[model samples]
Target: MRVLHLSDTHLGVDRWFRGAPTEWSRADDHLAAMRRALAPAFAGEVDVVLHTGDVFDRSRPHPRVIAAALELFTEVARIVPLLLMPGNHDRHGLSWHFSALPAGLTVVDKPCALQLAGLRLAAVPFLRDPAVWAAAAAASCAEGVDLLLAHQCFDGSTVPGFVFRPGEQPDTLGVQHLPRGGPVVLNGHIHTPQELRLGDTRVIHVGSTERTSFIERAEPKGALVWHADGGHVHRVDTAPRPMVIVRGPGDLRTVEPEALVALGREARTLEMEAEVASRGGWVASWPKPSPQMPLFG
Candidate 1:
């Protein structure tokens, strides 16, 4: 069985707070990139689609993003079965909010196991209670090929930096103890794609389809395509925009307006690090209005 794994879509997110581009345009760019990345799955090359979590950046998604997701999932469903589990950034409680989810999309609202293509998919949604989550995962995954899916923080990983959060299950309590019965585990939450081996089982994290934050500027953004029968994995790039990250300080105050403009033009996205000579100057550039400020009106 072949499966395309994708996660951390974060649709409707606009991380460009530097005022270089309009929010609408930045968000649209991400959505467009997502569509392009998913083109292969839409073309029918996979048997199942594993979406671990974070389909939206927030619990309340924009109407346009919701509409787009519904339409996109509708098309993808026609090609293959989609297994969707909510992440920390999603609405986990069984509520009317997710009522519009698409057909052929199986939402794992609770921890459960089901046989799919000869493998038992052990899935846990974003639960409010961690103790209950750990118990459920341990219980539901006792037999068959254990494909564990979840959105949580690793034992040593930090939230929104090293891990995803707002809601998270500690890795030690959940993932670390999963029965290693020779099943591949797929995860989504982290916004950078990575693959690791846990004994005989393979653990894959198919980061975000698009860059969701300025901090993630340096990570390679892509999706994971796994050939289950042969156990081969491939990465497909979906970062439609260039992300630039600069560390250490120079002086933004000394930077020419032309230089800043040029930097923005070179990449579709940009992040910068610099040292401000005065705290007053740094605070002055922030999202507050000041009589002495010329950067904002």
Candidate 2:
């Protein structure tokens, strides 16, 4: 059985750079990428579409974003069965809200086992508390081409360097706690994609479909195609609006307006860093968020 694996779609994400909101445009980019990712399914190349989690940017998505998701998934379900779970961002009572999802779309909000195309899929949603995660993990154990679909952080996963505020550390699931003996594990929650081995199990983080932050500019963005004997996956270039960073002396007057305008024309997102002369006569500088910031969804 062939499956299309996608995660961190984060629809309705309204990111800001230099104070300009690109929510609508970014949402459009995500929609376009979804279409590209689902092309094989439309052509009957894949049996099912498995979205690990983070369907919406926020717990309560904007009406427009909801509309967009409905329209896209409706067409996708027509082509193949779609299975989705809730991510941390939208994990609060998501099952209740989406309980009546349209035909061909199944929401795995709780620990459950689904049989799809001869595969045993053990779906697990986001569990904020470690105890809850442990309990869910314990209950999801199954056999036979077992595919564990989850939306949580896995220990030892690599991510772009970033400073986290106090008390903002993300919750993580230890690899040792996961069921062993060859279950193919697919995870979300981390924007960067990675493949790792946990004892006898294979773990794949499918990553985000679109670049959500400048820190992710260098990271690959895409989905995965998997089957019983393993399958191929590749990056999908959504071509998000360009983001440019400019550094200059503390004095804004020294920067030419024409130069700034030209850079703005080249990229919708622009960041400016100011450098100040230190007591030792050296420039002390640090980068700042673009006037607009990409807020966590």
Candidate 3:
């Protein structure tokens, strides 16, 4: 009854170099982190592998990224069953590139329940509306320890800037919603791993396998391991790869080439904050003529 939960691998992330890393060296680090994340799933220490969502950053991943994913999951399938769901980042009915993903992986494009030898997996694809998930959960309620796999933000006031929207409910997916109580629920999309309880249900999110966004640079990157029969749940920490951030006012001329190069030396992503300083600092330019910008008139 052992289960390995992993998500938000975000492979083929080509965003970092769009702003920083002229040579795109950070892309290599991203691939390295992805490789490390999959090392354990194929090590034969678990019975099942569940990837809630966001297996790739883009729906149309490069050939190499797709090949790497196929190879990794192909090897993993040799040991255990893998369940993969599509996230908002990588949705279905869009790209044919991801169609080449390995056959051992069960891609859940629509809401459905999959029953394997030692587990029952109820997977839901990327749907912002909570009613969709609620209905799916209600229909999939069955005997045995059912594992709910989803990808969405959760509502937690403690974590600022990353709270679930009005429709997202951590309570609905917990044990209360299930006909039988006590099923392990694993989630993704929130770039930090979390464990909590909701009405006797053990719910957890493994976050992203790699820090694919600049906002997640300071957050922890890891995966979650749990037994389907409810033994013990633990979070395994993965090393945080190097990330870079760059910020300055809207004065590109004032920035030096050496400084920009130095800023990107050890970092992979950039967070630029363009600002304007006049009589009053940090004022945005008015597109239309306004009292604040009387000179434009």
lDDT of each: 0.60, 0.65, 0.59
lDDT of 3 at 141: 55
What's the ranking of the predictions by TM-score, best on top? Answer: 2, 1, 3
Cα displacement (angstroms), candidate 3, residue 215, comes to: 1.9
TM-score of 3: 0.71
Number of the top candidate by TM-score?
A: 2
What's the true lDDT of residue 136 in model 2? 70
**lDDT for position 16 in model 2:** 30
Candidate 1 residue-wise lDDT, 1-297, digit = tens: 777888878776643333332223455656776776676688777778887888777787766667777777778877777776778777743223455666676767667888654556888776546566667767777765447887754333333455432245433333445454646778776666666554565667777887665456557777778886677888888754544332223334443321211122222222442322121111112333333312111
Better of 1 and 3 by lDDT: 1
Candidate 1 pairs with clashing backbones? none
Q: What is the lDDT of residue 174 in candidate 2?
A: 67
TM-score of each: 0.73, 0.75, 0.71
In angstroms, give how far residue 88 of model 1 lies from its true place: 0.4
**lDDT at residue 118 of model 3 (Cα atoms):** 58
Which lDDT value does model 3 have at 73? 75
State the local distance difference test value for candidate 3: 0.59
